[model samples]
Target: MPLSESTVLISEVGPRDGLQSVKSVMPTAAKCAWIDALHAAGLREIEIGSFVPARRLPQMADVADVVRHALALPGWTVMALVPNLQGAEAALATGVHKLTLPVSASEAHSLANVRKTRADMLAELRRIVALRDAQAPAVRIEVGLSTAFGCTLQGPVPEDEVLRLAEAAAAAGVDEVGLSDTTGMAQPAQVRRLFTRLRAALGERAGAAHLHNTRGLGLANCLAAYEAGVRTFDSSQAGLGGCPYAPGASGNVVTEDLVFMFEAMGIATGVDLEALLAARAPLRAGLPGEPLYGMLPEAGLPLGFTYADGRLPRTPSIPRQAAA
Candidate 1:
């Protein structure tokens, strides 16, 4: 089947997911600047930061401020990660454009990571939806299904469990449910099957695929997901992130490589390769000495490499109103 529009959504997750894994705390100003640069590169949606406790993740201490700064940028969807109802309320208070709630498919991993069972997570989702609807119905709610493919604590997670949680999240009132390869254990075949089931279960409500490159199959899994009709993909700038709790896991898929793959395939991701690579400046400056990963920046783009018709991330002609 031919792609209808030849375009895809590449969501930058470096601010939230990437920074949370590393020890260095990027200043709020640097974060805002990095986000602004990413937007200039044509990225429409970016996970600015997670609304977690400062004591836990000091890297995102100024998430509220970051939200304000990001919303000021035109043609950007400023997204924040919220762990529970409290985080959701705080994020809502900041008037973020989008909020994500994470739920794990593995019961063991869920309990260990968030100290909540899958059932408990579902119940929390219900409360969160009520709060969001009553208080900020305009803010989009996405439930990120972590460990949907596999888990470090429990090993292989069941597909039925993943699908069940996705359906429950959709029913609980989340606008979308995205799959996460939290431990980097997903394979191409597995990605295809699970994403197919996910889209079938939720239709357009099936959101992004947040894949990791721990075993070097991140791109393969992403390709599989794309083939299964997933349009939104989450990647970290310079591939600078991973699950801290998942001991052996590596970083999230590299934004440059993912963009290169899609655009090279004659599919438009709307992300300018050179400009996106330049956003790494803030990332490197913010976390000096921290190892950044990616093949494109090191190798440089191919001589004749052209973007999907050499197009940049399409910015809307009209500026959007900030979520108030």
Candidate 2:
């Protein structure tokens, strides 16, 4: 199906990426409620949780349950983060729509995050793909190369390395390969150039752009990737995540603001901004006292503007039922 002009797939990663980075744990029931509300807001895709070990990420200890709840929602593509072959196995067992494995482009970052060099991560990806092929061929595997723009430990990560990792991920048998600005050090020019190069190297296998607003360039970098032909974007609601290892950092690109930007530009995202904002309340209630980020929410919709529903004057309205 062709992508709708009024929408883009703003995959919410708050349950997985956002909550995992924080200290408190959101109850599984609350997580399910949040996911349900987001689906009600017209979010067709959601990264519900990660399949890592509870010892490693206690916040996602209920990933399997979250996946089950998300799958019960008709038409929603449930996604989860899987760090290695074992995590991939767990995700595949849940019958999720997609499983993303993080492969850092920066060798230093890769070693620090996953305790593996770049080559070692690629090998793990290959193993994960092979496992998926043997166990659950229907599940899609996505390799997200984190810290692609620049690294906290290794400054100015070479575009050559990023391109090489993209090529390696494609060769490693992943269905898709994405670039991530984990440290939020990306600029628009760098995003455009790298994504353009990645497209040339991996063709359609070139994956989504996972950007952070840590340095306040997340949206700009996203626009650059869009200009470079990326259709899918990974964002967190309320900007609710950050690198757990990277101290003093914020969350990924805010889903509310990102949807507002795309929908206002007349680019269909298939998401209701008002409903999307409403979904945030559960997130707030789940975490309580956590700082959420998004300019569109605080400032409200622009004056004299409209959304996909043809509502004018920029007033927030209840979401309409999606067409069958």
Candidate 3:
């Protein structure tokens, strides 16, 4: 499960990040079905769920079961979020391929989200790394520096603080450190600037772009990050999740729209736009009445649209927009 250079890795976080934000908990069977559909759509990496206490977050009470089911899917790199050493231990025991820790750049946001300061989180990361070395040497550890862009709790997080935290996380022995727009306040210019600085600072250890579309800038920020040399992107199907801990936080980058944007431009994402849209069925079925979001699903494909891999439409016709 090393990072693939063949296609931009779209790490789906709907199961973990998405569900956790919602009030209703999806059934275990439905979670598996949704995940299976995502795999069918060519999503190779998925954050199945978090390993936090069930009482704390009942939505993820069956995370271990979900992880086991995702593991059974071949050629998939299953990941789970772990807030601390305890969560990491439980996640490792389930044989998750990777573990992602959220380390917030904003001290106030960090305290609100994980009840730990930046220094305490780093110390926890060291302990988790040591445990990983001892028990699961093959498992990769990633840190999503949440609130890297900005925070609702602490208006604007300084760029220097983000870089400092990223460097600190790298030194704590994690495999990669990525930035998170937990509060959805990132603009395209800021995205490019920070990612560029991150690459310059962390080199290969700098990780994915976890942007939000709160201000309708998710795809734009992603494009900016791509320009800044970030190949991995985190998105949610139907735009399902945001940080529950961060006030007024909402909207993850929509997966179908993201794939469509890249494929329409002839940048292969290795994801089938049709299949990805179809995956939304199980998501809706799992959480009945829940609102789903995405433009491509409603607009349908353009006339004679061709995927980057050269797949043709089933029945090409004049584009509706053009015909109108």
lDDT of each: 0.88, 0.84, 0.93
Candidate 2 all-Cα RMSD: 4.6
Query: What RMSD does each model have against the real structure?
Result: 7.1, 4.6, 1.7
Model 2 residue 102 CA deviation in Å = 0.4
Best by TM-score: 3
The parts of candidate 2 lying over 4 Å away from their true place are: 4-7, 308-324
Where does candidate 3 clash, by residue pair?
Answer: none
Which residue runs of candidate 3 sit more than 4 Å off their true CA positions? Answer: 1-6, 315-324
Q: What is the lDDT of candidate 2?
A: 0.84
TM-score of 3: 0.96
For 242-307, candidate 3 gives per-residue lDDT tens digits of 999999899999999999898888777888777888899999999999999988887789877998
2 against 3, candidate with superior TM-score: 3
Poorest lDDT segment (10 consecutive residues) of candidate 3:
1-10
